[model samples]
Target: MHKTNFAALALLSAACLTGMSSAATPAQKGFITGTVVNEQGKPLPGVEIDVDNTLSYDSSLITYTDAKGQYRVDVRKLPFTFQVYAKMKLKYGDSTVNVELVPNNPDAVAGLAGGVRDFVFKPKPVTAEDPYGNLGRVFVERGIGEYDVDTAQVQVTLTPVGTLADGSAGKARTFKLLPSGGGPVIPNVMWGKYQVTATLNGKALQIRQRTDGRTPATWGAAYTGGFTRDYNALTPSMFLEVRVPRAGD
Candidate 1:
C-alpha cells in the first residue's frame, strides 16, 4: 500500500510540473437580456431568443420573450476563448429566419458578460443602398428568358387591394420590365394584397403567384399577388411569374 501511494504522489507531482490539471476549469457565469418591440414601440411577446457560443461546439441557449417582451438567457463562458452572440428567431409562414439584434454596447458580447441586445421591428423604405431593407418587395422574376416576348415592351401594373401594412393608402403603379437591365422590381411597396397584371406588346399576358408554389396549370391565369412573409424583415414579398398565353378563348 505504501509503495502504491508513493507512485501516485510522484505521478501527481509530475503532472503539476507539466502544468496539467485533472479537473476542468469552472465555467464563468454570464447572461444576456433583451427586449423585443414593434415599430410603434409596442412590446412583442413570444419572440424567440437564440444565444450561440461561436468558438465552442456547446449547444445553443434558447429562450423566448415574456408577456412583457423581455428575455434573458444564461451562458457558460468557457475557458480559452468565450464568445456569445445573439439573434432573434422569427417564424414566417412555413419558414423561420434569424435577425441580428443590435448590441447595446460595442464589445458587449465579449464573454456574454451580461449585456443588453434589443430588437425592434422597424420597417423602412427600400433605398438604393438597402434594397431589401423595406416593408416588402414585389419582383417580376422572369420577363425575358422564359418567353420570347420583348421585355422592353412588357408592362406590369400593381393595383392595391387594401390598406398597406404601414397604415398608408396604396395607389396603382405600373413599371416596364427591361431585359438588358435588372428585372423589374417594386422595391418600396408596403405589405398588402395587390392585383398584379402584365402586358406584352399591348397584349395581356397571364400571371401567377409562384411565391407559395401554385400549380403549373395556374400559371396562365390572372393572379393576385400572394406575398411571402419574411420574419427577419417583419414584412412580406411577392415573386411573380408570367407567361404568354396559348391558343384558346
Candidate 2:
C-alpha cells in the first residue's frame, strides 16, 4: 500500500513537470475597466454593464458603476484570442433599454489588453437604418364602452411637465392617432412626463395615465384577463387612456 501511494505521487509530479497535466500552469487573466457618463459628460452612477467575451467558453461577466461611475471586470485570457464587448442598461423615465455600448478606445473590442474603455450616452438622430431610435413609445387607448368616433380626427396633445433629460426646455406636441387601428403609439416623442389631453370633434375627453393598472369604469364590460394588469412604466413605456366622462361628476 505504501509503495503504491509513493508511485502515484511520483507519476503526478513527473506529469506536471513535463507540462502534460492540467495543473501544469495557471490560467492567464486580464481585466477591463471603464466609466459611464451621460451625454453632457457627467458621470452616471449605478449603471449595469455586461462584459461579453465572444469566442470563449467563459462568455460574460456583469458589473455596475460605482458612485464615481466607474466599473471593472476580470477576464480570463485563453490561448485562443477572442473579442470583448460591453453593453449597458439605461433608464429612460420608467422604462429601461439595453444598448450595445461603443468604447472610446476602439482597441478594447479586440482581444483583452488591460486598458480604459469609456462610454458616453450620445444619442443620434432616428433614421430608417436605426429602428431603435432615441424616442420612447407611448401606448394610447380609448377606454372601453366609450363613445365611438373617428380616431383620425381625434386631436391629442402632449405638454411637457419639466425640463427634458438633456436639460433642454421641452416643446409641446399635437398629433392625430392612427386611423387604421394599427397603432395607438404616439410617434417621435422623448421619454418624460407629459400632461396629456384630447379632443374629439371639438368635445373634450377625460384623460388619465393608466400606468398604475387602474382602469376606467366599463359598465358591465368583461375582459378575458380581467381589467387590471400591472406593468412597469404602464406597459412597455407609458400609457395615456382617454374616455368621454358622463356629466354631473
Candidate 3:
C-alpha cells in the first residue's frame, strides 16, 4: 500500500512538471507580409525592397522583396514598427512606407492572410528654395548621374572661410541640395572677399565669388559667380566655397 501511494505521488509530480514545461514555452511568432506595386499599379520585380525593424534601438531585423514584389519578415511575438523602402535601379529613384505590427489584437489582423498586405510607393518631391530675405544667396547644383539630392544621395554644407571682426573664425553653415533649383541664401554678409566651399559626400571643393549689394533676390543668385573649377571630377562630398563682401558693411 505504501509503494502504491509513492507511485501515485510520483505520477502527480511528473504531471505537474509537464504542465510547467508547457506553460514555460515561448509564445508563437508573428510575421509581416506585403506586396510592392509601382505608380502604374504593376508588380515591380527586381526592385530592392528593405524592411527595417524600427521598434528596437538596435534595428535588429531586415528582409527583401521577392520576384512577385512580395516580402515577409518573421519576428518574435513582440510588437514593432517597420520602415519599408523600395528602390528601382539608380536613376528611377526610391520610395518609403511605414507600418506598425500588433499581434495582440485579433480583430486587427482577422482580415489578413498570412499577415500579408499590399504597399504602394510614390517618388519623393523636390524641396523648395530658401525664402529667407538674406542679401547673399548660395546656389548648389546637383551633380549629373546623381538622383534626388535631398536624401540617400548627396548632402551640402557651407561655411565662411575668413575670420570675423572679433578675430575669431565664423561658424560654418550647412545647406542641403533640393531637386528644385533653389537652396539656402546667406544674406547681410559684410562686403568683403569670401570663399564658399561645396562638400559632396565628404570631399571639399572651393569656389571663389564676390557677394555685393547687387546680389539678386532669387535663390539662383547664390550661383552667380559660378564654380571656378570643373565639377565633373568631384564626388558627391566635394564642396565649392564662394567669396563675397556684404553690400555696405
Candidate 4:
C-alpha cells in the first residue's frame, strides 16, 4: 500500500511539471502603435501607413491610421528595423524605426507596432519670383530671321548651373518656349544669371547666351534693332538675370 501511494505521487508531480512548462512558453504575438501629425501639429486622420521588415524583402505590412491619427500592427516576429510611411492628400512622409522583441518585455519590443510617430512635413513653395529679389519678364528672340511661323515649334530647357555631376557645360536650366502669334517670351523670370538657348523644330539654332538681372534695354541699341521685329538676326549669345524672391523669408 505504501508503494502504491508513492507511485501515485510521482505521477502527479510529473503532470504538474508538464503543466508549468506549457504555461511558461512565450506567445507568438507582438504589436506596435504610434501617432502621425502634420507640420502644423495637427493629427492627420485616414492616412495610409506601410510597414516593411528590413531583413525580409517579401515580408511587408500595410495599415491606416484611425480618427485620432493612431495606428497599430501585429507582427509574428521582430525585425531589426522597420520602415514606416504615411500618405495624406498628395504628400508622402516616411521614417525608419527600430524594433525590439523578447519574451520578458514583449510590449516594449512591439511598441507602436505600425504607426508613424510624430510625423511632420512641410512642402517647399514654388513662386514666380527668382531666388534673388529681381522681378521682370524674360525676352527671347529668334536668332533665325523670317521663318514660316505656322510650321515652327520652339523649345527651351532650363538647368541650374554647377548642379550637374557630369561636367556638362551650357544652360544651368532649360525651358521650352511656346510659339505665340507675335513671338515667344517667358514672363516674370526670377533674378539670377541664366544661360539661354533657342531651338526651332528640334534643331539647335544658336549657342547659349548669359542673361543678367538687367532688362532687355540694358543691351542698348543693338537689342532694339536686332530683336524688335526681326527674328533672323537674333543672336543667342546673351546671358540674362531676372528678379526673384529671397529664400526662407
Candidate 5:
C-alpha cells in the first residue's frame, strides 16, 4: 500500500512538472455546422465565424460562411463551451454577431457530426408609443472598440425586427451617443423589447452586453465586440449597458 501510494504521488508530481492539465475529456468530440441569416431571412454569405472553447485544445476555431451562409468547423470536444463571433460586410456596413451556445448532451445528441444551430442577425429599432408603463432603460456605458476618444457620437438606431427588415418601416428611432458611453435613453414607447444598434462613423460598432451564460458573462468578454445577436435586447424596466469592445482590444 505504501509503495502504491508513493508511485501515484510521483506520477502526479511528474505530470505537474510537465505542465500537463487534467482537463476533463468530454464524452464526445466532433464538428459543428450551422447557417447565418439576416432578419429578412437572407443568408449572410462570407460571414466569419469564430468559436472558442477550452478542452486542452490549442485555440478557437476560425471559419467562414459559404455562399449560402453556411459553415462547418471540425472540433475536438463535445458538450464543450462555445463562444461564437460572426461578422459580415454588408451594404450598410459590417454586421457583427455574438452567440452563447448551450448544446444538448452529446450522449443523447443525434444527426450530423457536431449538430446544427442557426442564427438570425437583426437589430431591433425602437418603436413609438405613449410615455408610460413598465418602461425599462438602456445605458451605453462607454465605447471601447477601436474608436478614438474623439469619437463624437455613435449612431443609435432602434427598429422592430421585421418591420425594417422587409423595407416596410413606420416605426424607427435613432439616437446619437458619445464615445464615453451615453444613454439612459427612455423610449416614448411602452414597456417592451427593443433592438439596439451602435455605429461609429457609419460603421457598425461592436458593443458588449451581459447574457445569462458561463462564457465570461462579464470577464470572458474582453475586446472582441461584446455584441451577440440575442444579448443586445433592451427589456422593459431594465437598464442595459451598451459597451463597445475594450479600447485596447
Candidate 6:
C-alpha cells in the first residue's frame, strides 16, 4: 500500500474509533441538502450520496435520495474552515454512471451556513447496448510493470461534440495510477463524439484503439476525434499504455 494511502486510512480509522458521533448535537448544527437527477433532468431516487468533511477529523456521513430524489445530511460541526462534499455512485434506471465527482470544488459543494444548503447533480447515463455508448471505458497500463502506480498522476480529458443533445463537453477526471496503473475506470459518458487527450507526470501517453471487444487492436487514436460506437459492429475501447524507454530491453 502507498504511504499516502496508509495515512488517509489511519486518519479515518482513528476518527471512526474515537470521533464525534455520526451527527453533531444541535449546538454545532450544520446541514446540507440536495437533489439528484439524470441527464434528461428527471428526479433520481434511491441514489446513495456519501458525504465527507475532509477538513474535520471526525468526519464520515452517508445518505441516500428519497422518492423525490432529495437528501439531507447533518454536516453539523461546520468549523469556520469546514469544507464538506457529497458524492454518489450515480445511477439512472438500472445502470451506474462513471462520473466520479471531485469534491471540494467551490461550486460543487454548497457553502452552507448554520442551516441547510441545497445542491443539484445531473449524472450521465450509461448506454444499455453493446459497445455501450452510454459508458466510456479506459484501461491504464504502465510503461513497465515495475513502475510505481502510486507515483504516477494521470489526467484524462473527454470533450464531447458541442451540439450534443445528450450532454455537453468539458468532462474530465483524474486518477492516482492504479496498482499497476490500470484501475480507475471512467464511466457513464453521454453517448457522443469526443476528443480525448491524456498526459503523464514523467512520461508520454499513447492510446491504442480496439473496436468494441471483438476486433484486433489498431495503432491509432491518442486523441479519438469524435469517436462513435456501432452496436452491431464492435465497441471502441482505449488501450492506454505509458511510453517509458526502459533500460533493460
Best by TM-score: 1
Greater-TM-score candidate between 2 and 3: 2
Clashes of each: 0, 0, 35, 37, 11, 5
lDDT of 3 by residue, 1-249 (tens): 011122343356345434433221123236655556654556655555455555446564456667776666664454655554544442101212122221111122211122444444432211133222112233444333334333322333444445532134645445543332233332222212233444445544323333233653222223322122123311111223332223442
- lDDT of model number 1: 0.56
> In candidate 4, which residue ranges exceed 4 Å CA deviation?
1-29, 91-116, 123-249
What's the TM-score of each model vs. the native? 0.49, 0.47, 0.31, 0.30, 0.34, 0.36
Residue 220, candidate 4: how far off, in angstroms? 18
Write candidate 1's Cα lDDT for 13-59 as tens digits: 34442442211222234656666776466777777676665665765
The true-versus-predicted C-alpha distance at residue 245 of model 2, in Å, is 9.7
Candidate 5 residue runs with Cα over 4 Å from true position:
1-29, 55-58, 76-80, 90-113, 124-181, 186-249
lDDT of 5: 0.43
> lDDT ranking from best to worst?
1, 2, 6, 5, 4, 3
RMSD of each: 19.9, 20.4, 24.3, 26.8, 20.8, 13.1
Better of 1 and 5 by lDDT: 1
Model 3 poorest ten-residue lDDT run: 97-106
Stretches of candidate 1 off by over 4 Å are 1-30, 76-108, 124-137, 142-192, 197-223, 228-237, 241-249
Give per-residue lDDT, candidate 6, residue 83.
Answer: 44
Model 2, position 81, has a per-residue lDDT of 38
Model 6, span 75-147: residue lDDT tens: 4544434343434453323334434322212332332453332323432222222212234444445434526
1-249 per-residue lDDT for model 2 (tens digits): 011122343355344334422221133336567777765667877777765556556666667888987777664463233343445554555545555443454443334444456665553233223323244555567765565845555677676777654456677666665322324645335555666677788787776564344545332111111111135432234555676657663
